[model samples]
Target chain A: MIPGYITTNAPALLIAVPLLGAFLSPLIGKISRDARALWVLAVMTLTALIGYFVAFLVYTEGTLLYVFGATNATLAVPPDSGGIPIRIIFTLDAMSALMVTIAVTVGFAVILYSLTSDARRSGLEAYYTIFLLMIGAILGMVSTGDLFNFFVFLEISSLASAGLVAYKVEKGRAVEAGLKYLLVSTIGGIFFLFAIGILYGQYNALNMAMLADMIQWTPLDKLALVLVVAALAAKCGAVPMHFWTPDAYSMAPSAVTAMLVVASQASLYGLFRICFTLYGITLNYVTIGWVIIILGILSMIIGVTMAIPQKDIKRLMAYHAVSQTGYMLLGVGVGLAVLGDQALLNSYGMTAMEGGIFHIFNHAMYKGLLFLTAGAIIYQVGTSDLNRMGGLGHRMKWTMIFFIIGALAIAGIPPFNGFASKFLIYESVFAFSPLLSIIAMVVSILTLASFVKVFHSVFMGPPLPGNEQVREAPRTMLIGMTILAAIVIISGIFPEFFVQNLITPAAHALTDQAGYISAVLGGA
Target chain B: MRMSKIVRFGADVLFGAIVIFGLYVIMHGHLTPGGGFQGGAVVATGAALVIVAYSYEEVIGMIKKTILMAQESAGLVMFAGVALIAIGLGTTFFFNFLANSGSLFGMTVPFGPNPGELNTGGVLPLMNIAVGIEVWGGLAIVILYMLSGIGKTKEA
Candidate 1:
């Protein structure tokens, strides 16, 4: 294990470093603009390194616990407590580590992409400050074991991200979208807090492991479960609750939009944490699983159908985000439905979970690249409206290629990461119910068709007369897109390796509640 | 936008008292119910009182934006630095290494409903001050920015 000098404090460092960067960003900005950008980059890179290091340690050494204000990890036990952890606990298992990995990677990519992308905006210092704050809060949200702490981080991220989403001061539309996003997330956060209160009122514990062990599945707990799931699902953009996704995604700066994509995944992480680890087998799996599966199908069908007619490039891509999230919902929902049924689970449930988890990684990479490409086009052409763009591909060849790769991968084409994960979902979900797989396949085709329409409208045809001299994106932006594209390609071609090393372990850790609970409370 | 001279004078007089009360609340945070966030809000109310009485230009002069920004960053850096101290001391991050060590902000005391000693909160008091400073700066700056934004719109 890599539990060396600094590794033991990796959990806290992962959040602390970025938080330091957040305030330091504006300070450094006051001195010099370039210095502030470098500061943000340095901060994100440092936190990403710490994040991956923590993930590595957790992966290798089993779960690593870091308790705040405690002398050591084992000192988390309260003196007169009923085996409940009173201190703030950050429990990093493979699942949380996976989420931390995504947040760090996406955050790093967003920082690099926006280095030059947001040069035109005023208040760059404040922009970087909120961006870093959101990053730190995201890392906090994914890794913390305390429910109320999750709510706190959730609020911080919502505020920070809504601020970023409203970065374009001139674009009144962006601000409007930001306000709506904020209002919706505030309600969701309050609902989530109420759920936490219900749990706390019942068991007098905020720790997930403690609640998992002390659960008497009363009616109030069920109500709490509904509120938590509904709130988190809305936050993550599951179908029927995803109106904010299109508004927020389309209006945000491309860089912030990319990060927002990953942010939703954090909400997904929270949802999965509640479903699998918190409730585990104590909840009614069949009913809840069916509920999730239905939501997944709705998201897949409606998201792609909505994307087909979109003239706005970012809005189109935003709908695609909804569709991609559906695959994950389907994959994980299948796994949830079969919980405690050993024969069915052993046959295909695990693969479904791996597929869902793997898609989180793959979707982040491809969708980020896609958004950056969309941003690049908008940067050069001065609009995100697809009707207003054409033949910039000749000038921006690299961007075109990157966009094509992103489009194809998102369409679930072979030799790309998306195909590998979606294929796994299709192959395994068939075992549970072939109808669901058929619908998924049809949705994949519709997704491909939707992207083709976008590609034709935005990148193909003769150059528009006004944009005769349109140029490729800046060097840093291209480099950022290339980094994500390379990840998409590598994970696509060698997905088995990722599955074996990261996804399978994460899936196992997520499903195995006994191990997760035991990791926190010495065999419970 | 300055209020009448009487109101302005009253605001000026009340600001000092409000700030002093806020400081007391922050200093006794570990012993009392009101901590960093609450005390910072109380302090920010004083800033708001001044902002309400003075014109935008005069308010800018009275509460310099750059200084408030600096104070905010300083508070955050200090808060983070205190936590980072645990990392350097060969303990986990946020570990209360100073507690019960009989050092600065580290005096041990018996747990009870009795009045607690000022020096007995370990790093908690330091954290309170840091957060208090941050919240004060943050809230004042927020009001200033909002008013300035409104000012711009009216002129436009």
Candidate 2:
């Protein structure tokens, strides 16, 4: 039972440590204000350690699986399968393990940063409780193998994130936004549930691997596939289903807002898993790609256009979130459209997909950094309105520096993480389709323009009405932003390293539907 | 905080029925049309029923912000808990571990031929129940907060 020493089984401690910490947070919070936050940080630190170790195990030892109930008897077929039957399965390939590492790292940073921000002293113990739950749910979502189990985790992540948005009950707008997010997110969750139901009904199994074996090109299967993709799109804030993003981000506490940004990115990973694995990618997945492409293009145009007029900084970032999603999806969509056609998929489409997936991690780093920086500014200046913020660079030098790097990274400037991913998408798209490449280029340039405006208005101009006495953010916030800023820079410089290791595995995971399905349920 | 005993009794019965039905739905998810989320929505009806029958202030005071928040968060964590076990076991995300026919409390039960059968799947029932609690508690808290927030707001 010494699982850590066993190459085939990862230590369950990675998830246990954080979850157990979450359960004890309330009780510990009563003892000291910082106790719960520090406990969470410690838990995530442990989670990251375990995640990194597990990832190292998977990388060195190959794919590792642990059946829930420890069955001594093996299944009829499929080597490395369950022993005693009726056990929850945990399978870690490189991709899932990597994501766990990223999520845990970012989560730790966020919790640490919040400890020093006004979020700590805000008498929002319940808020931290939900925050920890969210981190745990995301960890669960990324790491689990059961499809039904995945849906449940999705709901947990969604609810906790929405709760974070409404943490400030005094802001009636936040409450309203939470409600809207709930309604839409609930619908998404329901659709996901329905898709699970459909898969179970037709396949007579909820195991992803077993279900994939049972899948055939039937109308019912197509419908289930559509429902799953649609539901995921809503969660990812794809266009038409993306109405909730701006309000939810604008209304929540800044710490919560930063967390939600990362949470949403994590959900996109789910979308990729469901679409590619649950429904075999070889079958008409390309059609869905067209749909996603259309949505992505629409979001890019509309999100930037909308951002041009925003007065509030968070709201603008909110629109940009949508626009950025478009950029990510552009590569994904292109890869999907060409998946069935080997010629198109080979040269650049694969690279494009890698670009999109790479951008997911890069976006998480830069966007989370930017949002935290925004939170820092709001912490000091007490406003997220761009028109109201001026000369903040002089008052909050570290915060401003972090914000500049984040803005540069987000705007796809050279020598930044954003540019690295955007370049992949750009070059790959040009090789595949000039028109799509043109659109992507336009989006990139506009992104730069938008952040420039943010810089000029928020950081460059004369000190605004109330910023005369605005002080710098606390050291904890600086640490979080600094960590992300360094990551962004490293990713930018080591694009090849990231693509070869992290992005390629993620892209391959998304593309290798058979591998994903077989790994989860067993070989068909 | 005072209300007629009859009114209070009626609300209690209604809530009791809804709670029971929601639990049944959640537990029977593997075998039936209803699952955790649907059952959770049904449970929230009990909260709504209580809100409608009682004074808003009383209902709000009884539930309390911290408790509601805790319930919502706990439910979320519970759902994640099942997945955490799977992660620890080195299975794929959300892999069901406890899905089998085993003797529990000296009762021998048969899980049907398919893994999809009720009581056959591993951890699904538990996950479903966790989701049920989350959906029930989360929706209720969200709605209550919204209603009270809106009720007190003045038009600009």
Candidate 3:
């Protein structure tokens, strides 16, 4: 079949449209501040609506590919027949669609919240523009089928995020944190480039689907695999490479910081995409799983241990971000390990993988809510320092309540979203390794303890000297927190809905090599 | 002051050679060793050399700030445009339209999907060049911004 313009490639538009919109924004912003914000918001809202339509199209049409420019019609190819993908390839599958849904919905909520708060409103035009680009980039990263395209989108998101982190140049550590983040992300980018070069050299192909079929695990292939995994681990803030995360989170403007944390999550998605979709997990090396599990364990221990000593509320939460990532990776890693065992693979392994992916959505909600609440506190009391704050429950009742809800959810309390996923992980891990389960439980307990310190210092102690003037966060911030809080609870109550509709399909697609290859090459 | 001039002259020649070499590499990406990223970085070095050799204001004037910005945006647009066109061509996005194995300029230059004329393959080489331009322009802009900040401080 010759491709036509009306092909099912709607996913590519979700990215291209917003990218075009981003370039138009600063010019539009130059006209008037309000005009700029409105334009960006309009574009974002439109992009979100388009994203919804794409998701709908995916469900209705099944797998669809949007070729950016032009393509050859050949279904199956002789050797050296297909050329490099010169255009952007947005391939929409169950996994990509799910990620796009989360990104756009959360993005909409964040933009709406920004409108109500004056703190973020002053830098309004630049904020919305960058925010929109971030949304577009993440959506593109998830949907793109080409390997080089993935790296381009990665750089777009990564660099834009670095700029946002340093946006608050007046803040003492903001620029320093941004610089450190830049250095590490640059290194990560180089690792990705090296991997890409090796893979390209081996197969002479950059398309994920094609590469999946062509890739044979030669010594060079193994080297590329190691490099790619290491790079992604750094991006995911997996232990040891996670040093820059807390500082970057602590320094960026609250709204930006809240949005930027999702970068690491998307990068984790990148890792899963490459490992399962590109590498086909059945290959006999247990090293990948072992390495991932070790990193997960270290992240859990170190993240929680570091959190125990943090006096700054933001820094503590950042550490928790690292720790929580451990749970997510542990689930996925356990799933990988158990794949060779039949009963375990289906009942426990898939369960663990689903748990990890579900936790991605869960963390986005609870952790984002936590950061927004922290932003609210900082807005009111002008400090994220835990030791300096006291008795904030009296003044900022709603903020404290929301914070508690988020904290509880993150602590994996029953009846919250976190617990539902945590339970799956615990059951899976316990079946595999009881010792790992124990450590996971210990990390959860310590997470709760760390949040308790935040609660006691910020909301329990007597109001600090000269702190009486602090007031509740504005309605906008409240709305942001409320939306995330509601989702956290709703997801907790209705785990099956999310699992059935989103998590299961995505997990299946992640592990489905035949499905991916057939979609790209017409048939295996 | 004279030493600065000598350093500037050396930097200028080095940067020029790098820029030319980078383009040479990118143009032959499909057949040979070099590609967009390497070439683009070299192009960015040319911009950096200017900053070192002359006043920031003077360099900005020579390149034209708007032109630099336009270059960045245009590269992105071109890259996307190539991909979109590939879709229209009845295949996946970014499908290479002009990949062949051929020799050019006394050198055997591989060009398309099959070894043929320069235009035989799809649009890959074009995309590579576009990406090269974007990388060069974007990095230049960033470095210029940082350098401008330094320029401001020196005067103050």
- Which is the leading candidate under TM-score? 1
Query: Whose DockQ is greatest here?
Result: 1
The clash number for model 2 is 31
Q: Which runs in model 2 stand beyond 4 Å of their true positions?
A: A1-12, A72-87, A120-123, A520-524, B4-156
Model 3: per-residue Cα lDDT over A330-437, one tens digit each: 998887776566677887788888998899889988998898899889888887788788988889999999899899999999889999999989998888899999
Residue A138 alpha-carbon offset, candidate 2, angstroms: 1.6
Can you write out model 1's per-residue Cα lDDT over A262-378, one digit (the tens) per residue? 889999999999899999998899889889899899999999899988889999999999989999999999999999898899999999999999999999999999999999899
TM-score, one value per model:
0.97, 0.82, 0.83
lDDT at position A479, candidate 2: 95
- Native A-B interface contacts kept, per candidate: 0.67, 0.09, 0.44
Identify the runs in model 3 with alpha carbons over 4 angstroms from their true place: A1-7, A59-61, A71-88, A115-128, B1-144, B149-156
Span of 10 residues, lowest total lDDT, candidate 1 chain A: A70-79
Q: What is the C-alpha lDDT of each candidate?
A: 0.89, 0.76, 0.79
Model 3, clash count? 36
Candidate order (DockQ): 1, 3, 2
Tell me the lDDT of model 3 at A398: 96
Candidate 2 vs candidate 3: the lDDT winner is 3
